[model samples]
Target: MEMTDLRLVVATGALAAVAAAGAVAVWRRRPRPGVPLRAGAVLLAELLLVTAVALVVNRAEGFYPTWAALAQDGTTAHRPPATPGRLDATIRRLAADPDLPIAVPWRPPSLAASPGGGATVAVPAGYLRHPSWRYPAVLVLSSPADGWTDARMLTAARQDAPTAVVVAVRAAPDLDPGVLATGMPLDLQRDLRVTGHRWGLVASDHVRRSARDVAGRDPGRFPAPVIAAGPGPSGLATGLRAVAGQLPAPLAAPAPVLAPSAAAHQVGRHRPPAHGPVSGIGLRHGP
Candidate 1:
């Protein structure tokens, strides 16, 4: 038999053995009436719990062939123009297979140094709404370590418009509060507010505060509609702050809030690697 089949058989046998032992003990102790029956019941309950946990963990890890999707941590994305069409097909496929909508990747803007020692923004891809590219674009603020991958972006793209582009912006660590803000800026505080929702390593609100403080000084230098995603203890505290009270909107408006006219654009081409995350960091993407 194949190794995989053998493993499955062994696992099944083990479970059966456990169940059989529980049943035997339960049967034998019932007439004798003692703590043994209680012990057997406990064992049975443990087995059931383990089974349920195993099933769930397996499914989350993509064991379900019919609806499996591995969460990606930063994979290279397809080139622009071609990306939209491919994303459309992928989203459609995922939607049908998983019976759920998918979020596709968006062409992000390029990052440059701002005149005020912050950062500058350049849209490498032209107007997304232009006949050339019909999808809308979203601006993201996070870390470069959590880079884009074709599968991840397509899976997360908005459903109504599968072609929408996502622009994820990463901040520099040096821009943290210790570096940028003498006092916390509202925008910086906002970035700190939503850090709790992260899954992995997270940055401190002070860091985000500093970065945003600097970025905010030259708001025009960055893209419009910024969404921040952070991870870790500090990030969680920030998320609470953000939820407890609204922070001043970032320098840019989130794409959802843009007017139809604002969403429209003239056809243009963007260079690859338009934006790079801060060195040696991984950040979360925003909704």
Candidate 2:
């Protein structure tokens, strides 16, 4: 949720409390005959007042992106910044390529089964070109909104001890909200399912297929036996959490890292070689 929205909620709650107290005070002093009705009337009025307050609050905070227009003026002009990463750059290039292969040689390599019986797709740095498996892979779900750009993504892979791979499912175009509401948590799995149905596949059935496609298309890009996985804001833990239901084993929870560890060293170990360079991933777009 946006900080502004949170403040509004808090303010509305406070107003509701104050209004309720006032209603009770008014009830205590009312004459006896229609006391019950008087109390009910006051309570109803309070409720209406609270609702009005909440609507005004919503209008001010602009929490609902689709319906609320009051705050749209402030947000419409902003564009998210982009970062470069090898994978992000590759994905962006792939998205932009008019002549991209209708059928890229995609295959599903067997992934390490999560304890929950679902498979995890990992995209390590330079899975396309890097030789050393010395970069940490990030497990992303949907694409990063801002900081997790292609360049930034690649930079993360290059800079980290173990390169990162984004973990995400493709979604239907209709599912793209353009701008998500401030407080609504994204459910990529459901969105992907809806998106898959649009593509003429069963939603649940296609997740595995998508994962397989990711694995088959890029082998050895994701290092098997993951050292540590970090979830980015949208993609990380949430994506893993969604996939857990389908994983073969329980996925290990990520640990907080103040700094890179031995595994981080392992992921970045190959940068000294000619094929390896300690830099962020390349990108194809200016955005």
Candidate 3:
């Protein structure tokens, strides 16, 4: 059973036990007229207490059922299949087509068994013409409910600033599939988005591998010191990766952007700052 279901079950059992105990206590009182009312009050208070405790525990465990339905709604929207070797072929084609405008949309690579199933990569402007130019890479994590597309990343890239490749990783894998399958009511699924599987470490590895693969295919197109960024839940993941020394570039994002909480910032503060040439364009938050 899912954590939420399990918690509910346990709470129900606790409530039953409390009711039974109250009944027994009242029986032992031996015919006192007020005993029934006292027992009912005791049972009601115990039930509420159990429910409150369950809610608190569920929140602490990050088991938000409300957002699950919304997340499910967006999960299957327009995910193009990534056939084997297709990514490499696409990159080569883009490189060869030097005359093609950078504004054109490039297909994202299909990540193998990725927590989010796949990732969207946005190449920098002039990538086709500047064969020898090495650009920094940025990995942007997306929210579980609303996945990002390569076009979104391209829009976020600055035209005047030094161009860098942007990769947006989806949070689909981090969400619980069970909740999606059940088709839970909208009201119940309206809480907050919960983290199902712990995909942080594995997802980071996938990002590094992706970076290496991109750099390897085009020779000098992408370089080291990748910047990890995001907003909302993904932003928190990005900050955690930065704090853990996974990202070699300093974390940067606009003030209005949803950065990691103060506690997360504290964790990242103690770690050594990422080293390398910082990108002129940091994290940009928008639609």
lDDT of 3 by residue, 224-263 (tens): 3233453333333343333222222222321111111221
TM-score of each: 0.23, 0.28, 0.29
Clash count for candidate 2 is 55
lDDT of 1 by residue, 34-130 (tens): 6766676767757765765564443222122111112222252211221123234333443433333333332211122312233211111222212
Please list the residue runs of candidate 2 whose C-alpha ends up more than 4 Å from where it truly belongs after superposition.
1-4, 30-41, 45-149, 161-287
Off by over 4 Å in 1: 1-130, 133-136, 144-151, 159-163, 174-207, 214-287
Cα lDDT listed for each candidate: 0.30, 0.30, 0.36
- Residues 115-142 of candidate 2 have per-residue lDDT tens digits of 2222122344234343222222223323
lDDT winner: 3
Question: lDDT of model 1 at residue 122?
Answer: 16
For every candidate in turn, the CA RMSD to the true structure comes to 20.8, 19.1, 16.2
Candidate 2 lowest-lDDT run of ten: 193-202
